[model samples]
Target chain A: MRNRSILIISLPLLIATLLVVMSLSITLGSASVDWQTVWRVIFSKITVINQWVEPDWADTTETIVWDLRMPRVIQGAIVGSALALAGAIYQGVLRNPLADPFILGVSSGASFGAALVFALGWQIMWLGQFTLPVVAFLFGFGSLMLVYFLARVGNKVRMETIILAGVVVQAFIGACLSLVMALANEQLQTIVFWMMGSLSLTEWSYNYVVFPIIAIIAIISLFFARELNMLSLGEEIAHHSGVSVSRTRFYLLILASVMTGAAVSVSGAIGFVGLVVPHIVRLIVGADYRLILPLSIIGGAIFLVGADTFARTILAPREIPLGVVTAFLGAPFFAYLLRRAKREYF
Target chain B: MLTISNVYKHLERKQLLNEVSFNVGNGRCVGLIGPNGAGKSTLVKLISGLEEPSGGTIKIMGKDIRQWSVKKLAQKVSVLTQDGLSPYPISVFDAVLMGRYPHLSFFQREGKRDIQRVEEVLEFTGLADFRDQMLDTLSGGERQRVAIAKAMVQEPELLLLDEPTTYLDIGYQMNVLNLVKDWQERESLTVLMVLHDLNLAAQYCDELILMDEGSIVKRGTSEEVISAQMLKEVYHASPEIVRHPKLNIPQILL
Candidate 1:
């Protein structure tokens, strides 16, 4: 039996593309900093010795590179990777090609929490500009737990029930969020901005808060790639292949939800990356999650970094929302993928 | 190789398997012959540990099914269903390679030995040529063959098959059964399968277990169990009993 040798060649190329894309996103900004200077400032800010020559750039440029653009780009990468991996996990575990990270009401529940905060006007900045995200994570996680419990029949949690429960919870919570938006007067604009999903406000400290949560989840998810493959075959078959279906499902769903909640909390339901990147990766590669998981991680980072760059740069000082950019870029690319490919992607 | 001292399964308000007790000897190709809703598939489910019996126990290789960890049990037992794994982006080689799932530990990739085993099984099942083809392109018979190849790679001691040939054409059905018979004879594999075709079941299985209304109607050789009188009593429809031209086994005429 011959395995697909494509993964070996593609993985390295994809990773190299991610590096270049991350660098290009950093370089494309208004600072007029060359790619070489971006590296120099990046090096100087980190290293204590100051290395070689006095930098030609101003202090404000360094602050712009290190403080603003750098965090935003890295935040895009982190949130993108987390959401894409979450989508892959959901698709594998639920055996639904349409499954996304937020298919289970995480966004609506999260937005409800954020909308509540906006309604009450509580901007405490609890963890260096992370007050809203933290509260949103808590409520998003609560909704996932509720959906889990609601979907349980006897001891088993079937995929159909999970989707149904998600639909119910999302519709119910989305209505509540709209109600919050309606009744509020002064904070409506802030709530609307948060709902549109932006990474502009992310700073060095926000990365410090979110990076570990996502990295840990991603590594743990990679370890379960084989299990995910077995799971996608269907539950009864997974049992025949030696997986404890319910238990593995419990762990995988939690892992996906944690990462999804973390992503949504940080960047207010950044859709399309989670929904589209995994599908594109699966189209390019085969159905194996061992390849899909890691490749989605890299592909997602590149995509979001590139999208965020365009989001900030395309409109110049007036910046489009990140979610709008992702939808615009992702939808047509996916449509092209559907029209061109003769082979079955799913 | 497999033991069922006394097992009872209740799905809803009714008992699916009522005080059922049977033991399958090692290397024996035993056929479960029954009408619809007769608990044949339910028994397979119990042995595979997908659902537990309400009252009794099932043991494979002398250890209780409940006591075995999922991976350990899977290494020893493989279950093949009616609708084989199909219509996915996975190739024949990868789908067959998934049989090695139970053997590999967490964070472990399939090694040279596992790949070698998959190759051997694919060759044995005559699937080496179809190795790279997408699963959905294969016919129903070929899909079942791929499934058997996967099961063979698992190297299970006990193979539980539920309705192994429900959708296959007669020629394909014989091909599938002949493959199973060959594998069972060569490796002394413990075989238990629910078969819908009475004639094929009678020809392939060593001993026949007849079931009706959730109880054992009779258990014996095909000659003893497939008689016209017993068929009418249990099935409420009589079919003419005849002998196979070549093998002298009892067959049916509807």
Candidate 2:
């Protein structure tokens, strides 16, 4: 009961924080725009109840807010929510608290695809656009199938074997990626930069592709939250408690991996949001996935926005990679949480 | 009522349970007693529908076990496997509330009655004070009691207990078995419990099935099956068979 009330209060508080952070992020870009102007521009764009005269805003400010920063911030929030939701699902399905979105080799597969695109100079576009992200998503999905097949032992797929198989596949893919980078005459720096992960190129087009897919998948996952709780009880007990163990595990793996693949395809394998946000939410909400899933979504969006805000402003104009910023910020916070947590909650 | 006939369980080529058969009547506490490797646990698994029989049938109340869906079977039956630490830090109330899983729809949260049922069971098991405690925070005995509370909330017609008391002091052992015994009598619950301790089995069970080598060697009242000769032959243990002076039941002195 106390937990439920805490969740109730945290929900609105998190929303308020997200709003404040997002508005602050909108105003803190390379362009110097006043806070009131930023708010007016945003409020005027929305289809509010009353009709108002258009605010006389500068074309540059409008372009920067709508074209440049708006999509980036929204994409960051979406990707953050997707990655964290995937991470929470993986942890619950595998019954390992350490499991992350990339534990199944999705990130490695994505990196390999991106490397191939960069090294081969493959301009092969998909429907005349987004060749790299499309390829990356396909490779990530294909990697999941490969890991699943490799992990299967007769009728059952043990979690340990799946994790080990993922590690093996990831290592092999990493070697291939390195070979690509080593052989490429030039564009080596470009490959390395992309491999490090960035959201600088986020646009409304990318958002259009990623948002629906992730939002749909994440919502579908919420329905299975109870099944996820059953699964974490260990397989045999879960089966006895009316969970169709094999079927539930299969569906959850597919859903989580697909979401992770989508996020990685867009964000170039952003790390730590998936790993860190879920842990933080779990600490606050306890282990009930019903609460944990939605909270992780909101909390993840807030976390990445904050992290990306820091990444851009800390250096100003020369931005560090998103993955680096997340790891730098997430690792220390995770460590403090580990120290503060006295009992094993997972 | 539960019935098992010609149940054969084989792992690869090795036989775990070979042609085991037994019957447990309604409201009766039946103890499956045997030494290690006798497949008592395997038989319990088969009856609970956790494992399929190689060549036989298990029927609950008249319907074949295979006919029931997993969820329906869960509603009718509950099993408590050997105690292990819970991987998640589930609260005691929520842990017991999981017993209502089979009864709940996919989107339905636990209703008021469900929570009330859990509260009653927690109180009945003397775990009311520990209701908000993390399951892992409790001692071994308390965790075992939590397991019982979880299972009892299922309101199962048949309860299958696998090694309900393996590592515990005498007080805990009796506390667990006594709770089962009281529930059995009050609700007319059919019990098929696998017990490692011979004396406790002989004391608590209404009927005893002595098993050896994945087969039932003897099945009868405590006095008929727990003889010194049978113990030496089946268990390979030399034990003196005596009587409980107060209850007038057979007791094994090892």
Candidate 3:
């Protein structure tokens, strides 16, 4: 009851925080727009839906706010929520708190796929403007299937085998990625920048494609939240309590993998958002997925929006990699949590 | 309520149980007493449908166990193992309410009756005060009680316990058995518990099945299954057996 009430209170506060951060994010870019214009442009666009009044503010200001920063902020929130949701499911299904979206080798495979596209320079437009994401998602999901099959001993995939398989697949893909990088020196910058993950290239088109994918997945995952709660206890206990262990594990794996694949494909492997957000949320709220899932979704969006804002603003006129910013913020918090927890979770 | 015949269980090319057979009547508490490595846990696993029997058929309530779906089967049977504690932090109330998983469909949430049932079980188990506390915050005995409460919330017709009191101190052992006994009578629950303590088994169980070398050596009332000669042959220990002064049940003293 206490936990439920805390959730009820914190959820709205988190949304308010997210809105505040997003508004602050829109105002913090290289071109500074006054708070009044920012609010006028937003509220006029919202209240006067079709008849958006020409902002008395400069055209550059309108373009900067609506054209550039808006999509980036939304992408940041989408990618953040997707990765964090996948991480919670991974941790629950594998019964390992350390498990993250990248634990199954999704990031390395995504890098490999994106690097392959760069090396080949095959400009065959498959999925309109987001061809790179499509290819990257397929290859990333392919690598996950490979690791899964390799690690599975029989009907069960042991924890040790999963870690070992992930490491092995990651190393193999890393080798391939380096070979591609060395061969295609001219395309190296494009590949490396994408691998570091940036929201700079985001457009409303990308949002149009990515938002529904993640939102639908997150909503579907909530239905299985209770099964995930059972899975965390132990497989046998879960089975005795009427969870079809193998089926639940399989469905959750697919759901988490799809979310990770989509996020990595678009954002080029944003690290630690998936790993850190769930842990921090679990600490604040308890480990019940019913609460953890929704809270982590909101918490992750807030975190990434705040981090991306800092990334674009920290070294003004020169942007740090979004991944670097997240790692910088996430690693210390992770270390603090590790020291504080003292391997309690392990 | 439960019947096993010629059941065989093998793992990694090693036979764990060979031609094990037993019948547990409805509304009776049966204790399975065995030495270490005697396949007591394996038998419990088979009965609970966690593992399949290598070569025999088991039935429950006159229906073949294999014919029932796992979810439906779980609705009628619940298992309590010693190591069933949640490693993650889960509130006692939420953990106990998970026992209603079988009754709920995929899209269904826990209804009011489910919560009421969990509260009743927690009250019966003396864990009502700790309902909002996390499982990890509870002590060993307290956690065991929570585990029992979780199982009781399942409202199963048959309960399978694999050394449920293995890690508890003696007082907790008695407490656990007393709780199980009280519930057995109140709910008319059929219990198949694996026990290490012969005296406690004799005191609480209506019948005893003594197992050795992955097979049942003897099974009958406490007086028939637990004797000085049988103890010496099965456990490789010479224990003096005496009748309890108040209960008239056989008690083993070493």
lDDT of 1: 0.88
Could you tell me every candidate's TM-score relative to the true structure? 0.97, 0.96, 0.95
**The best candidate in terms of lDDT:** 1
After superposition, candidate 2 runs with Cα above 4 Å error: A123-126, B84-87
lDDT of 1 by residue, B1-254 (tens): 89897798887898898888899998999999988989999998889988888988788888998889888999999999998775676788888988999998887889999989998998899999999888878898999999899899999999998988889998889999999999999999999999988998899999999988778889999988898888788788888888899999998999
lDDT of candidate 3 over B126-192, digit per residue (tens): 9989988878777788888887888899889999988888889999999888998999999899999
Candidate 2, after superposition: displacement of residue B31 in Å?
Answer: 0.6
Worst 10 residues of 2 chain B by lDDT: B81-90
CA lDDT of every candidate: 0.88, 0.86, 0.87
The root-mean-square deviation over C-alpha atoms between each candidate and the true structure, in angstroms, is: 1.7, 1.8, 2.0
For model 2, the chain A TM-score is 0.96
TM-score of model 1 vs. true structure: 0.97
* Best-to-worst lDDT order: 1, 3, 2
How accurate locally is residue A134 in candidate 3, as Cα lDDT from 0 to 100?
Answer: 82
**lDDT tens digits, residue span A89-175, model 2:** 999999888899999999899989988988887878554468888888998888888999999987678999999999999999999
Across B42-118, the per-residue lDDT of candidate 2 in tens digits comes to 89888887778888989999899899878889999999887643646778887788889999987787899998999
